[model samples]
Target: MSGYRVGDIQLDEPVSVLPQAHIVGNIIAPRLRVAGMVYGSTAAHDTIILKDGQIWGDVHTGRLEVAAGGRVQGWVSSLDSADYQRIREEGVVPAIEPGAATAQDLPANGRSVTRSDAQNTLLRRLQDEAASALAARVELEQTFDKRLQEVAGETTARLA
Candidate 1:
């Protein structure tokens, strides 16, 4: 394929295949049907149909229809007006001044980290903590179930 970023690639076809096409940016096409692969985020204004295609990034569209063979591995966001506004507000990070007076401003704590770094760290910590908690909960439930089964077995033996 061509070095098409698909930043503004528009298609009016009922169905289209972007095989061997590597899109590095966003896609904004309505009523489009794809049967290839997209490595970037997709924003469909109306509807998007995916057939045996792979989406490795985020998808923000109005209506998405995935065929039985289609696959999306990343996040999916709604394109509703309200959702758009909320995303715009929440997704945007305010610029931070390096000289701003804050505990993080102290260079002793390692050079002030970038916003992206902070976000990534927070996300990673949350993921780890959540996984740990889930594992602990599962273990507790299993132990409780085992104890209950043992108690039930003892009672049955005594009754017999």
Candidate 2:
């Protein structure tokens, strides 16, 4: 489909949601290719999300391939035994409208996130990891040196 649609979709054959298309409900298909936007969950045997595609709800598929720039805002999981039943009887889950922000998007600290905040967090983690690795290396060198000294002393005593 290449336009906007507003209902649940169920099909046995392969399905494609082309660019500029938008679907506002769940999709149940054996195979799917999405290059547009989906505002609801999808259950498929194979699902491919091309660049420029976006899915705002959960996806359950046996095999999934996503190209760079594809976006899925919800959970993704492999299909389970009960997925078939879900595909047949499931309803669409509520989705946040495009560009809308929800409470979940907020940080637990209740502070708005900025580019500096992200960069600072990444820098802190890297610094901590570097310090930890340096400490480990120092400890290993100390242990090796101590063992070597003990071995040298023992060898001298045995030779004497």
Candidate 3:
């Protein structure tokens, strides 16, 4: 869509927001290409592409591609291919019942976990997040190269 403002968009198929479009709430889509601005969360099963777009909240995606001028100011969590496939098949992440057991509350084998362990766990999680972000940037560079190659090929084909 073009030149529109929306709130809380959810999609089961592919969707794209053209440049200058603005979305004020969450978006859930199989594949999403953002060329505008999104002020809230986004979850994509296949991929999330930001081409000169801006996002101010969390993003959860299978694959991510951000162009040179694109900007994101919040967290990004990448799902593995298997997770993406599952999401595609199920249409949404599995529902976690309220008050479900979590690492913070439960210890493996009922062992007593301490505050130090929690701090260490947090540290590790942060470290992993940093690594994931770095990996995403690397993947973006690789994707850019492939895109450049495709563009060159198209140009050559047109000339021929």
- Measured by TM-score, the strongest candidate is 2
lDDT of each: 0.53, 0.72, 0.65
Model 1 whole-model lDDT (C-alpha atoms) = 0.53
Q: After superposing candidate 1 on the true structure, give the runs of residues whose Cα lies further than 4 Å from its correct spot.
A: 1-15, 81-160
What is the Cα-based lDDT of residue 152 in candidate 2? 100
Q: What digit string (tens of lDDT, one per residue) describes model 1 on residues 34-96? A: 566555555554544456666555667678788787876545665776654443445431222
Number of the predicted model whose lDDT against the real structure is largest: 2
Clashes of each: 0, 0, 0
Candidate 3 lDDT by residue in tens digits, 54-110: 766667787788888897756567777676666556554432222334456766765
RMSD of each: 17.7, 20.6, 13.8
Ranking by lDDT: 2, 3, 1
Instruction: Supply the global lDDT for candidate 3.
Output: 0.65
lDDT of 3 at 80: 70
Which pairs clash in the backbone of model 1? none
